[model samples]
Target: MSAQTPEAPTVTTEERPAKERKVPRVVILGGGYVGFYTALRLRRRLGKREAAIVVVDPRSYMTYQPFLPEAAAGALEPRHVVVSHRRELKGVDTLTGRVTEIRHADRTVTITPTEGQPYDITYDHLVVALGSVARTLPIPGLAEQAIGFKQVEEAIALRNDVLNKLDTAASTWDPEARRRLLTFTFVGGGFAGIEAIAEVEDMARAAVGYYDSISPEDLRFVMIEGSARILPELGDEMGGYALEQLRKRNIEVHLSTFLSSCVDGHVVTSTGVEFDSATIVWTAGVKANPVLNSSDLPLDKMGRLNALPTLQVAHEDGTVVEGAWTAGDCAAVPDLANPGSYCSPSAQHAVRQARHLGDNLGRFLRSAEPTSYEHKHVGTVASLGLGKGVAQVYGIKLRGWPAWFMHRTYHMAQMPTFNRKVRIVLDWTLALLFRRELVALGRLHDPRADFRDASAAPRPKGAQKPADKAPQSEKVATPAP
Candidate 1:
């Protein structure tokens, strides 16, 4: 004690207390829509060190989800859609961890990091920005075979898987095998499902030209929806036009139809039809993250936090949970604009709310009154395939390249950063110069040569090797666009 070791010195409770320090700490959860923008805006408004902003996310980057379909269709580069959380959030301390629970009673949150022991994070104020997850139903074989189109990795894997199917169809001479590989089904007629089906079908149709054997007609595209109509946002007129456009492409749109059962790669519909499909995409709907259920905050029917118009969370007693706030799809904030209708889960509302949430957080930090969040609905735009599309934006009906241009134009304007916008624009510009690509890069999944050796095993004079080996890119088939 007389001679303090220079190598390691002891710190007292005064230096670092079990309680929080004088720094005004703000803890924002999730790095998606609400989380990233909230952190970025807060950092901008709070000066250099007005408040200590900490962003906790399981991922280091915020994925701009709207561009996912384009990415899968090979229209946009995969990397451009993601905005780095650390790079964009300059002064905000970033922690890579999953928040297991938020103990509002103690003003503390427990986090489970990817590694190391779990730790507690204390915050003077908290922003719950945990985004929504794919809304899944208890459908048989769904969890095993069907892939969700919500995340980036899933989109990439789906693309590879789709291309893999085309290669399999091309390599095998068996009619049954070829039919199975070429048959693709999507469950959901929403914007995500429709766009995905359209783009994939278009891409496959284009690539079929490369294969002398395979024709575009060999590729089967089926869409099954439980609802009677598609693109609920565009209303009946545009919706009808969208359906007509898809039908014109030979896409089998089955309204009021869904997967009654899917065992292996075969799907049995409620209408008694059964078929084999190598690819099945589920983009039905979305729900709040289950992490919200772990928190003490009051939640709505779908497990979304009940947020006030001011963006603060309120208990049953109508009192704000002092430093707690929420926004985006996961928050059930009262819609002051409409009397009873709640906010729909869309990028449009989430983005606008994120800006407002950031402004509100800034106001609260400086003891200024926070602003209430309220925004009106803009229009909806959807791209069918190639230059074919349909959109009803602000009561204006558009189709063909006009709607397609509006789709790119609107999303480009809001595609996160100038850097990404440029890359996406460049992708589109190149598309103008060149034709749409439908080549399937299915071989990227496995790099091993043993399977190839096994498949190419020496055979008897008349006996044939079973066509069961994984697909390759070299067996490249002509695209179907």
Candidate 2:
């Protein structure tokens, strides 16, 4: 038995006019490797009271791009590869928008938001990690035809697009139409282009299961590269192995080929070749976001900000820009590991450099000495669908299933949350216990087509079944002589 007591009146303190927070607000632009890791480490090092961190970007999720191929191939779930900023990054304000300009002198930025009203945000310390945008060409009709491979949504869209193509080909009776629908062309032979082509091809092959008319041999997948070889980052031997594996899968690897035009569905190559395909994927390369060029900071030949070893923006005369720092693809920092080289634009470097930048920023704020950003380059690894892959680390080469397994293991550990990781592990475990499938649900986009004409046709009153009022076999027709 509990005694019920009367409640006392709540005491109100002499409301101190919301004392202004004394800590400086650290505004981070772009929620990528440099932006995410920068804020994440900053919060851990400085505590919430020392400074407030605000992360601004068009998306609140950080994409673990290495597993994108797996997601497309159904080896990993699409959601598992994306890390939620609001959920994982504590003590940070996440703003979803793109920054148009930076007023570095005033320590302020003019951001043109994607929605709502445009606004200006002021900050004490500014971190520019806007990263890069897709590098494109003046080829005709590309803007309307091509897609990028930077985000999770893009991967999922591509997967759906590929499966849809398979479905279109399967149900079509026209030979030319079926041939065109089954053709897929990918430009560039870098990590993105190769992995994307391989994974989508794998998924499309699986989708052929439900199609009695379409066979795996009917599909044609092509990879075009202007360079003499593919996987230029992986060096020669492993790159050769990658080419062989692609050839083994029946994917045409076109070297020293270029895209001249892609008007409508017709694609013309520099090697005097032409084809019509339902899909054309472009993963050629990337360029620094032009917004960085609008800033007053010193820029490199390619318009990337000339970043100091300390990850701070410096002038042509070697002086740090006040309260401004830059990292990732937007910044060209010196590569101490190799003399006379700039750091390559990569996730491996950007993440570690971002962590260091956060620490250096804190050290600078506390009047402590800052350290330079230096790192050793770990080698590259790539998957070739299913249990095929290639890897080169520390001058050692690994191939086949071993490399593929290593690739999955490495990225799984790197995949953001425990919940997502568990789901991915479950997906893989179930995959091992099931049979491979090539199933495409293309009609999901429009399931009303079959029933559309039923009511519109002249029908009897209260027609319960369509077959009831329909004419019977032989039509009971009699001819008079």
Best by TM-score: 1
- Where model 1 places Cα greater than 4 Å from the true spot, the runs are 1-21, 437-439, 443-481
Scored by lDDT, the top model is 1
Per-residue CA lDDT of model 2 for 36-85, tens digit only, reads 88998888889776788999998989988888877767777788788899
What are the TM-scores, per candidate, against the unseen true structure? 0.88, 0.87
Q: What is the lDDT of residue 164 in candidate 2?
A: 82
For residues 47-127, could you state the per-residue lDDT of candidate 1 as single tens digits? 755788999998898888878888888888778888988787899899999999988778899999999999999988999
Pairs that collide in candidate 2 are 206-437, 206-438, 207-438, 207-439
- How many pairs collide in each candidate, listed in order? 16, 4
Pick out the ten consecutive residues of candidate 2 with the lowest summed lDDT. Answer: 472-481
Q: Model 2, residue 182: what's the lDDT?
A: 89
